[model samples]
Target: MTTLAVPAARFHPLRDSATMLRRNLRRMVRYPSMTLMLVAMPVVFLLLFVYVFGGTLGAGIGGSAAGRAEYANYVAPAIILMTVTATVQGTAISIAMDLTEGIIARFRTMHIARVSVLTGHVVGSVLQAVFSLAIVIGFAVLVGFRPTAGLGGWLAASGFLVVVTFALVWLAVALGQVSKTVETASNLPMPLMMLPFLGSGFVPTDSMPTVLRWFAEYQPFTPIIETLRGLLTDRPLGNEPWIALGWCAVIALGGYLWSRKLFAREDDR
Candidate 1:
């Protein structure tokens, strides 16, 4: 008599992801200091930008025409963006550590779904980003950075920014997977993070040099920062909004493809 082997059916990926999320949440609860550090770093940066840099940048904040608004008002969105951007480093480093330390390999041996481990990290990062945003926004309000757009507009603006932040997460995930050392993933966000300052986030594009003006007008950060400002401050939604979204989409798609390639390569090794 010959015996034949039967293959087991694969479990649903979604169910696997749900389990990972529960595990991730439990892990986050266990490491309160880790969560607090991510939130606290951004809040400290916000303070530095608001007080130490404010007087130097001028009360107008990088020289905006809207003198009626305080410097804190102009820079609030930037700080919020920074909060999201900064946390990407933490996410990237954490992911790299897991991959390098063979923790990810250990997960592969488990009966639970493999993807959940990664998904959990992402969900946790998003939650942490949201908390950082809240911290920055709360500080902005406390410092008198009132948004003229009212509650509805503010929410819309925040939602837009969050969309950009989500796109950024894919890039971070990709980098984390590709980079060998935790340091590389940790510092990568700094270069991309400066795009906003070079664009309209800090100063008006028109007043900038002709070359910079062109870059500022066309770059993704200009549109995002401006659109966000318009949303928060009731300014007009310039072409910047659409342009910013386009840039984000392009980066997100590119980053996603590269990230997948890198992750596959690493796993095969």
Candidate 2:
């Protein structure tokens, strides 16, 4: 029995995680509206900015000749980042629902790997984020946004976005576990969605007031957006990419530790 138990424990982790991932994917399909709503917000913002506000903003950034086209190129990175935040917001909501609905309790009693439950959500959210990004980028292109990134740039940008998504998804998982209710989980990540607006996303940080500009320049999202922008537009990145990765590492580690603690507490309860 001891020999059997050791081998089962070793083998079950991957299998259990795969099973949980499938469960999450099925849940996503079962509830299509949530996915649509999550994807729609970023698309709406992209359209609103590029069409409604792009011309004036474009002139401010470059000149009147650049117009909406230039602004679309400039704002596309921010919109992409927003897409990731929106998708992870959904992850928090989903996690909260699982906890509140007693599915977690049921999972606790099962022989499955405990960590697999959270990993399922994390992997599923990342996939959803990637899908949403593709749709948003396609829309951006349709609206006159052009990126000059070569194959390597595109690959690097894709990898960077994945890392960002992974970090944010872990953070969302922790936020979800910390919430007492689904509504609270939904609200907790609200600040994340707002960060892009407050950072260098919509306009240059230089244009902000003294204090606001300082905050915008130092915030995690600013460097992240700038790194992505540099990759996509073939602009010189300087140090923003490293700063962005450092931020991601911090957030990911904090979130992972918090999540494990929370899950253990739940088990104790």
Which prediction has the highest TM-score against the true structure? 2
Q: How many backbone clashes does candidate 1 have?
A: 1
lDDT of 2 by residue, 52-119 (tens): 99999999998767788999999999999999999999999999999999999999999889999999
RMSD over all Cα atoms, model 2? 2.4
RMSD of 1: 2.9
Clashing pairs in 2: none
> Candidate 1's residue-wise lDDT over 2-90, tens digit each?
99989997866788887776876777688777667766765776677667766656544444643423667777777677777777777
Deviating ranges (above 4 Å) for candidate 1: 1-7, 55-69, 111-114
Give the TM-score comparing model 1 with the true structure, all chains together. 0.86
